[model samples]
Target: MKQLNILLTAVALLLFTQEQAHSQIKLSDIFKKVTDRQSSSATSAGAPTTSEIGLGIKEALQLGVSAGADRLSVKDGFLGNLAVKILMPPEAQKVEKTLRGIGLNSLCDNVITSLNRAAEDAAKEAKPIFISAIKQMTLTDATNILLGKTDAATEYFKRVTSAQLTEKFSPIVTTSLNKVNATKYYSDLTTQYNRLPLVKPVNTNLTAYVTQKAIDGLFIEVAKEELKIRGNINARSSTLLQKVFGYADKKKS
Candidate 1:
């Protein structure tokens, strides 16, 4: 009985010593592995440098801008898409209603069509403007966008380029309105409305109106594209895009 007790104590001590040494070795290895990962994670884990993120965002913006331009620059781009279709300004609503009530529905329709046509024409020039804004993006901008809301990039564009867009788009909208005889139709509507009893004259700047609406519609499309790229795994084209947006995807999951 004594021998049995002695044997058990020795075995227990041996196991305790072995376990303590094994745990020390394992803890050291684990810490070393963690340190190595921290050191290499910049180039590892599909390391996406800031510059790579910048380029990826730029590429995505370029594609988004080009796609938006192609879709909007065509006939019925705005007129056909009720989601983005431009309606008469607030001041023109009375004019439109009065004209339509007088059996001048065709006249009103022509004015509406011409307005949308002018917007579509002005939209052709938006691609370059959007590209310019994308090119102006810096590493900081890219990083923030990658970590921001789906529409964050689009909002950045409004902050940086709205003034420039307004300046460039106003003239084109004016030219396009004239080219499509939108002015003639608008004038006819307003002249008739002014002749109506108890109606105030509308001196709305159609050029500025269309220009602002066109810019708004352009941003809507851009936001949609940005959302699609951010949310859709298959939409990520480049490796950098995969890395940057993949991080987003993981967080979302």
Candidate 2:
């Protein structure tokens, strides 16, 4: 009888211990889940939403485009800026060289100046095109742009708006070229070059060349503006910009 009573007590003690351990494990799991949920909620609360990301990216792009267009549209914008100044086409380098060789320096200078003038004129019309592209940005695009490389937004603009910009800029450039007498001067330069003894005739498309250069210059400016906004806190002008880009800054870090 004593041995049986001892065995029963031992069994009861073992079961009680097991039950306590099981309860502890269950409580531990519940606490961990609650903590996890709280942490996740905190993270989400600190992060920007999908809509805010899209709006922030759009705002940044618009500001960039406007600044870029405004800088290039002013007088001496392209002419004074060596970075974007339109010059003689590669195929016409020989022509310019030949023209300048024979006391035609004045005419060569005129051609270079007029080419930049046309580009400057065409740059004035880029803001609207860029704004339209910004308006069309999707949530996927916004997220990618925010996390992508320094020039990702600029690349996006180039990819989406290049064709439309070309279409819009061609006529404006052509008109500007004529207004500035670039066409006449180029024709005169090429004519003189072609007439030179033993020289191959060259007929480069001035309008097409100038249009592409102008587009490239605008993109360059836009890229700079984008970098400024991403890397500099002060560049975020509005409350929305600050909130959106602040979230981006945190994510990047």
Candidate 3:
């Protein structure tokens, strides 16, 4: 009977030990899982997702395009700003100089004014094209822009939209030039210059020249807007902009 009691006690002790070991394993597993979940959450909290980055980039571009278009579409936006003012083409510089020397300054002034006016009119139509390009940006493109140089976004826009902008701006510029009498004035100026003794015939494509200049001016404005958003915290108007650009700032630092 004593031997039977000893055997039973040993069995009970063994079972208790096994139960404690099993409980310890389960507790360890639970703790590990909890720790892992907390770590994952913390990591996610610090970094912006790919989707967030893309959205932020698009928003910034939209703001840039809108601001640029609005500013340039206004009166004297190109003419008043010497930085982007449309000047006579290189080949026609002598014509302007000769005309001015002959006291035809008023005619030269009119041509300059009309050229700027046509650019302003075309600038108003650029917002839609820029917005469309912004919408079409892929995740990879957005990621690259976010991490690229200060004017990387502007470069991307130039690459993607230049051809389309030219195609669209050609007709608009042509019509605007005709509407503003730029074509007529330039034709008259060139005709007069050609009639001059020993002067080469100078027939510049006013439409092409003005269209390219207008596009260049628009890009300059866009670059400024992009720089503002990338560098200035206040320019980040939305929460997403703040979050994504904040991440970018940290990464750059």
**Candidate whose TM-score is highest:** 3
Best lDDT among the predictions, by candidate number: 3
lDDT of 3 by residue, 1-253 (tens): 9999999999999999999999999999999999999999867888799999999999999999899889999999999988899998899899999999999998888899999999999998899999999999999999999999999999999999999889888899899999999999888888888999999999888889999999999999999999999999999999999999999998999
Ranking by lDDT: 3, 2, 1
Candidate 2 C-alpha lDDT tens digits along 1-253: 9999999999999999999999999999999999999999877777788999999899899999999999999888898888888889999898888888899999899999999999999998999999999999999999999988999999999999999999999999999999999999999998889898999898988889999999999998999999999999999999888988888887889
Clashing pairs in 1: none
Report how far residue 56 has shifted in candidate 3, in Å. Answer: 0.5
Of candidate 3, the 10-residue stretch with the lowest lDDT total is 40-49
lDDT of 2: 0.93
Q: Work out the TM-score per prediction.
A: 0.80, 0.80, 0.81
lDDT of 1: 0.87
lDDT of each: 0.87, 0.93, 0.94
Model 2 TM:
0.80
For residues 37-118, what per-residue lDDT tens digits would candidate 1 score against the true structure?
A: 8989855775477778888889988998889877888999999988678888889988898888989998889888988998
